[model samples]
Target chain A: MSLEVKELFKKYGDKVVVDNVSFSMPGPGVYALLGTNGAGKTTSIRMILGMLEKDGGSVTWEGKPLNFDTCNIGYLAEERGLYPKYSLMDQLRYFGELRGVDRKTVDERIKYWAERLAVEEYIYQKKGKKQQSPDQLSKGNQQKIQFLIAMISDPQLLVLDEPFSGLDPVNTDLLKGLVREQIAAGKYIIMSSHQMEAVEEFCTDITILHRSKVVVSGNLNEIKKASGRVNLRLKVEHDISSFIRDAGVELITEKEYEYVLKVTGDDQANGLLKSLIAAGIPIVKFDLSELSLHEIFVNAVGDEAKEVQE
Target chain B: MNDAENIYSIRGIEKVFLFTVRQTFKNRGYLLSFILFVLVFTLMGPIQYASSQAGRGAAEKSMSKDVEISDVENVFVCDQTGILDESVSDLGSVDGNVSFVSDESVVSDSLGKNDIVIVIKTNETGFIINGIISDSSDISNDTLDVVTSELQSIFDDTRMKKSGISESDIELIYSGVSVDDPVKESDLYVNKDGGKGKENKIQSGSYGLYMLGFAMVVFIVISMSSSYIITSVTEEKQSKLVETLLVSVRPMALLMGKVVGMMSYVVLVIICGAIGSTLSSYLMERFLGIDKSNYGGSSYDFSIFTSFGIVNTLFLVLSILLAFLLFGMVSGLFGSTCNKTEDIQVATGNVMTVAMVGYFSAMVIGFMDNDTVNLLAALIPPFSFFTAPVAFLGGRISGVILAVAYVIQLVVIVIVLRVSAKVYRLLLLNGNTVPGIKSVLESVKGA
Candidate 1:
């Protein structure tokens, strides 16, 4: 099924938060939505979920308008909330009831999750009374429960906000694997995160939000190539000021000994290499680097927008 | 956490609410305190009753107001029931009071004299007698007024006769003494109409307990359900569970679930209080052996008290239920709006204030009749239930009227729930504080 968001606009009083945002994201694979803080990323996610009313716009899933029924689609809001006093099984079952899951399955799924999450010891406790609370669990464990709350519905489209947050590296890896598992099972996954490595590793398609507008989006590699950005690394015997004065290449970073240049445009890097050699700059090693998602973010939303406007 | 990637549904939100309530009750600190406190207070019932039986003040004053006959008392008495006969004479001689049921036995009613006054028995209604004035007794005019008011009550009764005299009877029934001269020199602070007697502490205790039951029911219903809401929402927000649930289920549904959960809590507390009250009252009556029927009813027959008691009990129960529903729903709506436990504290704090105001206002309204609160309370959301109970207690309203008020309040609650649910869906997850009172208007205006 296709999700289409057209000309969406949201205003907070006189301030425009989501301005004429438009997108058509067909799911079944992870879609990485990227943005800086205060970039209206959260606002747009809320609008897309139909949780917040837009000033003027439309969001349709499979050509049907969004409403309570469309709510069957799962979501993990940017700020997740679970009953602090809820136990893992109790908390999961409670949400399962609201989602209209069968009563019998709630227990089954809860058992499954408890074992899978390795939180079984925490369940079925007679500590005080009949119930357990989420607060009794650790934060990471709480996040695990929150994740299941969104995923247990087996929603056709899953929207996760900062799923990797508060996760240790190992747990993050575990969740990253889960994302692929969901995708392989033919579930659509759309995740928003500030982690560039995670996005670059898993997101097949990406959307960058800046100042309440989409600045750059689509296939990660294609977007990077279109900007003519090539990651470069170099090793030199000595610092050469004359070798640095190149027409089509710019330094990306300079360590104490070696300078790294970002070469742009076709043939620009080859000609720069020759120019550097003719200047007798001893290059020990050089290789084209892979583009990081952060560079892409800075390219699309950082100084590029300012330079273009000027 | 590999298997943690299982599916969840919005229906789980409802389960969460119920689970929270059950756990709250199961919590040892609160439940233990509540049980212990109520039990201790309940045991005090027997102690209070025993110590209060003989104390006298207003008890004596009010006692001295009802049906006192005296002196040669020439008892010209008649009774359709034939419960008393001629040997009952000191009859007219009830202590030292005499009556002339002759030409002047008649007294004026607001509707003019229709042989309304009864010295002993005149044309069926009780006593019709005029006391001859003696210049001697040192009682105040206020006492005379008290005697007149009580006599008015006795004369209106269709079947009362003088008899069954006891040694202590004379001391309690001497309100009006005949004196031609008015004592204008001394100042009287007591109500001109209410005339004071020795106030009976046990009787006052009885009234206080009745009111205590009322206030407890109201406070427990509102507060218990409200605390359920606060803790429930706070936990949800804190655990980040609300985010996903907000997507699949509407805020209104979540709100409804919470309201239902809290409603269960309120209902439980009310039932408990009712049981406690019944037990206390039963114990008090057994121990004190009070004949409070005369203190409260319009006639010695006590049929009026019985009928009024039934009506008041029914209305009290129903109004309390409706009022609790209204309060729980509104508090749930507001509680769900907060995004953090601390935020919930602030949110429910404001909600608690409203409940407290409504309850105290209701208590204050109990002492006055025909105030704006009496009229306003019949329609105001939470206050209606309370005021209706007070009115029923005063015998100021009929069951049909109370039932109508209850139905109207129920209808208002339904409307509020429906409208609140709709708006709640849109606003539940927003991190900003909604302007409290104006939110409804803003929703209606869609602004």
Candidate 2:
């Protein structure tokens, strides 16, 4: 099944919050919605989910108008919360029921997710005993419960906004495993997060929003490839600052026996390597890597700001 | 994956409705408030009855002391006609404390110490009778007339005896002379036109029912259901859960689910209150023998509820239920618009003020019994919710008027619900304070 969002637009008064935000995933995969604070990522997601009214454009799933009634979808909002005074089990069941999940199935899914997410101790209650409320659980555990609720329906289309914002490393990995599992199961997913490494780990296609506008978008690898390989890492027994300077390559960093250099392409890296080898530098390691998603995000957002300033 | 494969089965609104009701009952504060209200309402009738009874008893005691009808018994008579002794002795039914003086010279002296003195003297026409009473005696005119009638009867008897007439003839003449079918005096306050006028006085028990009904509306519609709706909506909004839930259910469905669910909770509370109070009051009167009448010193006729016909009772129940639904939906809108807990309070507080106006106006007009005011209050949308029942119960308005008022209320509620659905959608994702009144008004206008 395909999920297509075309030219979505939203505005608050005269200030546009999401403008011409467009993308599509023809098959099950992770699509990342990346942006800075107030960058309209959340607004775009809301519009896509039909939670917020779109000023312009349409979102369709499998050639039909995308809506709650038309499609089964799950959403994890960035500002995470639960009924703090209510039982975790109850809230989960309620969320499931809202998504049209039957009670028996919801209960089974609750048990499954609780065990999978390692929150069984907090969720299950003894017979004739009062269940624990959300307030009784820690913040991280509450987030686990929130995740459990979001995934309880086994939705085909899952939208997560900052799904791991306040999670610890172990819990984050636990959630990440479930997300990967869903992807493997051929479930269409869209994730928005500030963690670039996490997005890069799973997301294949991405749209980066900056100041309510799309700055960089399309295939993750293609965007990086177009930006080019700009960095090289070298570790040697001796300091290579002079050889790097001789090669006319800009040294990005030098600490102890390691050197990081900026280069234009493979030719410049090969020329630097030749200069280094001829100089009889005992090179322990030489590695050339493309710009990280973090660098690419910062550069794209920064370049947009510069353009605006100009 | 095919489109059908992506579809997940969802439970109907029954699940949400059940969950909401269970949660409300689970809330200790709501439970406590409900119980407290029931006990208070149950005891209201007995307490009011006792106080009125006490007042009635005290009034009867004071009334007996205020009138001195027995004081006129100390009357003295001087009969110089010589036939008065026989004539007066023949009148066996005269209850006056009359004593004859052997000496006429002592009669005037007797008047100073006694209440009054009467002298009967034989004359050519018939007999001359004169009465002397002290100005300070304070005898009422009715008491004086009684004494005068007895003396005149004695004179007529004396004349009839001299004319050889019998007592039977006198009885026949007097019996026929009396006016038949005397017109009873009535005040202007009475229902002079015999129209469907307001009952000038309602039975105490009926008044109590009116009060109970009014309080029920206030508690269910304003206090309990509104607060529940607002809190539930705001809680979902705060947690940002509404967005996710919206994707699973339509905005209208979600809103209606929440509202209908909370309304069920409210109706349960009201029913519990009604049952608890009724059961407690019954047990108190039946087993405990606490004597509800003793507590409520005055005697009351049957309860107003008892007098109501099936249709009236049905109307009462339906109107209140509709009114509550309307209130729940409107309050849901308020909660949806708010961004924080305090904002919910402020927003609902405005609604409460408006509801309070209707509540108090119903009460004031209920007692005033002014036709214009009652009609106006009963026909208004929400105020009609309170006043129409009261007017119907008190006989101030007809059934047709009440039905029309309910129709108006239904129309207003339908309109509000439609507008609220739109507002609910607009404000669900909005995290900012939705510019309260103006924003909703504008949205409604746009719709």
Candidate 3:
């Protein structure tokens, strides 16, 4: 019931592409692998899925090697691919059959997914017209077909790499909803994306890689809680720049009498708010929140870059 | 990972095979090419026969128009063979006074300047018709030739009539006469002092042509099928479907499936070709009254199945299949090196060069009439695939040598498959231009 990837490593000649990456699922949930471009996110996913040769370590499920025999797995690769000249229905059926799904079930699943993803017209041929090929469909539609192929077998473990890269907002929401459903159905999923908010919405645990090494790895909530509430948002009716200077607060940004500040803890925030009240500034808004996933990712990667520079 | 794990697996091969076959048939270009292949093979014989018949008719008409005998005043016929009658003088377009003479010497001496004497005499081989004209006669050579030709035709007709052979039976009588020096069954494959024993010179010449022809056919079949394999492999690569496919099936399985799938198409085309050729032969014989056996002036007893019997025919078929698989695998290996659709032509060219070398070498060596060279060529790969079967059927090489050639071909096929599998696995994910020999070697080493 758990997927474990331990100390996975990959190197090409003198370049270490994925170095000592490790993580585990422990249960049915979404685990996110996030990093900047060329940060080894896709590489780690490829190694875990056995698509690429690993220089070190093993990927195991339920204490055994993870493979097609041990667990039914689905992979949505970063690079979207389909037989451009082949019919979409034919490609989907072929993928389903390759994964050992029977024809009847494959057709049923295709029908279900085609309808659910709103691609039935492209997949099913009308009276005399030809079935649509991948090339004939738009790129977003082609991606939907690829996604359907990954889900046709209804695999227990699914790995999606950059699943939302080129999708428009509407299609992105559609995919996000499907991921949530899979989570609800108790399937183990690993998703990698540059869209931080999407990852934040679905992932319970995460590992952030920078320059081929993990900089942050833990449950999302625990990581956020440990960092504490350091972001302060304040909105006032009048200018409070002079009182903010007296309280010695770090001014991150200001716009139209509303202020965004950084503080060490609640004490600093309380002191700033107390001064604002005593100065008789009408408090329109005062909010304290933990760091967003985007901020956390930037800070972690930024710190790593500074260390490398030093 | 072990070598077996990395390089050998058939899991999910059937899906790959079926998909490849379905897509290939769906491709309009491939379907059109297949139809054309069958049509050409089927119509080739009939077309050639009809053209040759037309050429013969035109030649006859031209010859008749060019011949003139109006200057001759008389034609004296001496029927020395006793087969011709007084009607022999009326055999041609001669407007002269035609008369039969009793003695050839007296008639020949009495021939005037404008007269020619037609003498029909029997030799041991057959009748010999000679036109005799006086040394001072003004009769032209053309006139003499016309008279001689007319006398020969008359003599033939009269002789056939005297012998009671009907006109309809003339074709049967003049049909191809096949000569064979029968040897004991065990002596068929026995090479007596490295010499061809009891081999008819004419049959050997025909057999050489047959060998060359068969080698061309093998070259064509392998080349066409290998190109299909190359295209199929590069299609998958160019579409960037390798990663998704690798998860479902191993590299070797994918390659094996595609090769077998394309070969199945080749087999279908070959069957169609056989049907077309058979149809053409039937059409020629039934409608044109032309018999292939008699057309070339030599017996066509060179059919592999008929000449070598069933066992060797099976062996020949096996060698052909192995040869096809070997070439197909090599093509797949080259195709794996391709990263783009543009690389397909170069990959196909590399494999075709190997096939061309095999085909031409077999053709050139097959015509040499040397048993040792034929036997050696038949035991070598690439060439053996093309030459061995025909050589064995022609008795240029013994059965043992052919069997040895089969063994060598199988070994070569195994080696090629292994190498192909290794290269395919190593390079399936590589996204670069077609790799060179050094890169391939490096990849192989790493694998």
The candidate, 2 or 3, that scores higher on DockQ is 3
Q: lDDT tens string, model 3, B1-447?
A: 210134467788899899988988999999999999999878766666667668779999888767667888888888777777776447567778888888878777666899888777788998778888899998778778877877776677678878989877965776775543332234334454456565422245555766777777678878888878877778788777887887778777899899888888888998888888887787778987867653432222235444456886687668778888888888888888877777788888888888899878876886776878887888887788888878877767777887788888888888777776666766777776453344466667765
User: Alpha-carbon error at A154 in model 2, in Å?
Assistant: 1.0
**Candidate 2 residue pairs in backbone clash:** A100-B9, A100-B10, B49-B296, B49-B297, B50-B295, B50-B296, B50-B297, B53-B297, B53-B298
The candidate 2 chain B region of ten consecutive residues with least summed lDDT is: B1-10
**Local accuracy by lDDT, each model:** 0.61, 0.73, 0.80
Residues A71-151 of candidate 3 have per-residue lDDT tens digits of: 898888878788888888888999999999999999999999999899999988899887766788888888888889889
**Across residues B1-447, which tens digit of lDDT does each residue of candidate 1 receive?**
111111112344556467656666766765774575466446444444443433445587677665333212122222323333324323211332323333332322221211122233345674453332224434334433434444445443322335544535544564576432222212212332344642111122222334444655677677767766766655555455555766766665577667776676556554574477457756556776643321221211112123344654666667666777787777766665665566666767777888787767665655444445555665565677666665545434445656677778889888777767556654455556452444444654452
Candidate 2 residue runs with Cα over 4 Å from true position: A126-132, A303-310, B1-12, B41-220, B277-306, B367-375, B389-404, B434-439, B442-447
Error of 3 at A130 (Å): 5.3
Error of 2 at B216 (Å): 6.6
Distance (Å) between predicted and true CA of B295, model 2? 7.0
C-alpha DockQ of every model: 0.28, 0.37, 0.50
| lDDT: worst 10-residue window of model 1 chain A | A301-310
Q: Please state every model's RMSD to the true fold in angstroms.
A: 13.9, 8.5, 5.2
